[model samples]
Target: IDRLAPSVVTAALDAAGQGTAETRYLVAGAGTMASLAVRTLVERGVAPERIMLTNRTYQRAAEFVATFGVGAVRWESLDVELQAADVLISCTGATGVVFDRDRIARATQDGRPLTLVDLALPRDIAADVTSLPNATLIDMQVLAERAADSEVVSDVAAVRAIVDGEVGTFLAAKSASRVTPTVVALRGMAVEIVQSETERLEARLGDLSDVQRAEIRRALRRVSDKLLHQPTVRVQQLVDGPAGLTYADALADLFALDPSAVDRVSAVGEGATND
Candidate 1:
């Protein structure tokens, strides 16, 4: 999704030509999504110094500049950036409109055409923003619809297939992940039993040969793997099917496992890997 968004942003810039070194851009958010958008613009040939970032939180603006190696200002200082910017991309997750008609009109009164791209879910740019002279507002839904219409029929079909395949893969991976903790716990129990029995036998026999102990350990591990094999495969198959989520929930419930524990594990794993 991150990759796709940047590609889309790049294409938009190519079409709009508003992020060149000569053209200034303002990104009005320092969140992860906004950072990505800004990063994309910079990577696509917009000079870092030419781009200005503004976030509601001063610290967030600072953090964004530090993280993405860009120039940023607090929202309170937006007017300075607004006067010079040719393009504005707003990805702030604000509940209400961040830019109203009056604010946009004020920016345009300075004599520069303003293009605003609002990527917020509830919309950061008010509906009246576009009504202002020299102001053009583009939203995600509009861009998505445009992309959808412009997409080739075959390409659209291919994308749908890819989405379905990816959805299936994610579900299967999730389902497999769901059972992992239970499997680990069960294996831990088995290993404990084996160790206890080995200790008892060693005590009774005075001392068992090292080779015999090693063989017993390997055998116990093999037995555990064999016991777990079918269920693991079945669980993965269930995850690939239509009832995958339901089956995963049932399995987790049946094993008395915490679903949130699985989610936490997945989140940790994702954090560990850069992707």
Candidate 2:
């Protein structure tokens, strides 16, 4: 979901010929949505030096510049950046308009074409910004209308299908993570049992060779894998079903496994895999 929205924004920018050298892009937020927009712009061959970022929090704006900066200007001076920018993608979560008629007028006075994208729910750019000469405001509602008009019926359906598939994939991944702790706990129990039995057998058999120890380990591993195979597959299948998390929780509780452990394991796995 995070990745998809930015690609959409990039496609829009590419369609508008904003991915070129002559365009100067300014993004006014440091949040996830804004970050994604910035990332998209940078990825689609927009020169970093031609970009400027301004956030309410100076530190956040600086951090954004540091991470995605490349050639981006970390504007401690917001007004200066706004005045100089040719294209502005405003995704700020402000309650009121961040850029008004005066700002729009000033930006347009520079004689550069300005494309303002107000992606916020309660639009960050004032309605009057569009009235200014050379300033074109493209808000979310307008973008939606444009999309509906321009998109082919089949392409729209394809996008919807992609979104649905992504939603399902995310839910399945979450559900699979939910049951992973229980599986781990079960495997731990099996290993403990094996170790205890091995210790008991060691006393009876007296000193066993390294080869015997290796064979025992292999046998235990095979047994554990065989024991877990069916339940593991079942859990994976359940991930695609409704109430999968609930079923996973029930299974965990029934097995006396800790529910929080599932989240911990999932977090660790996600971190490890960079997902």
lDDT of each: 0.70, 0.71
Q: Which ten residues in a row have the lowest lDDT in candidate 1?
A: 148-157
For candidate 2, write residues 1-275 as lDDT tens digits: 44345645654564455445777888888787788877887777787777788877767777876898633445457677777777888877775788888978876797777888876545688887767779887765555556644543344345557656866776667767766766676666677878887777777888899899778778877887897788767876785678776767676766676556666776787798796
In model 2, the Cα lDDT at residue 166 comes to 67
TM-score of 1: 0.51
Runs in model 1 lying further than 4 Å from the true structure: 1-4, 11-15, 149-275
In Å, residue 183's CA in model 2 sits off its true spot by 52
Measured by lDDT, the strongest candidate is 2
Q: 210-230 in candidate 1: lDDT tens per residue?
A: 998788778877876787677
Give TM-scores for every candidate, taking all chains together and pairing residue i with residue i: 0.51, 0.50
Worst 10 residues of 2 by lDDT: 148-157
Backbone-clash count (model 2): 1
lDDT of 1: 0.70
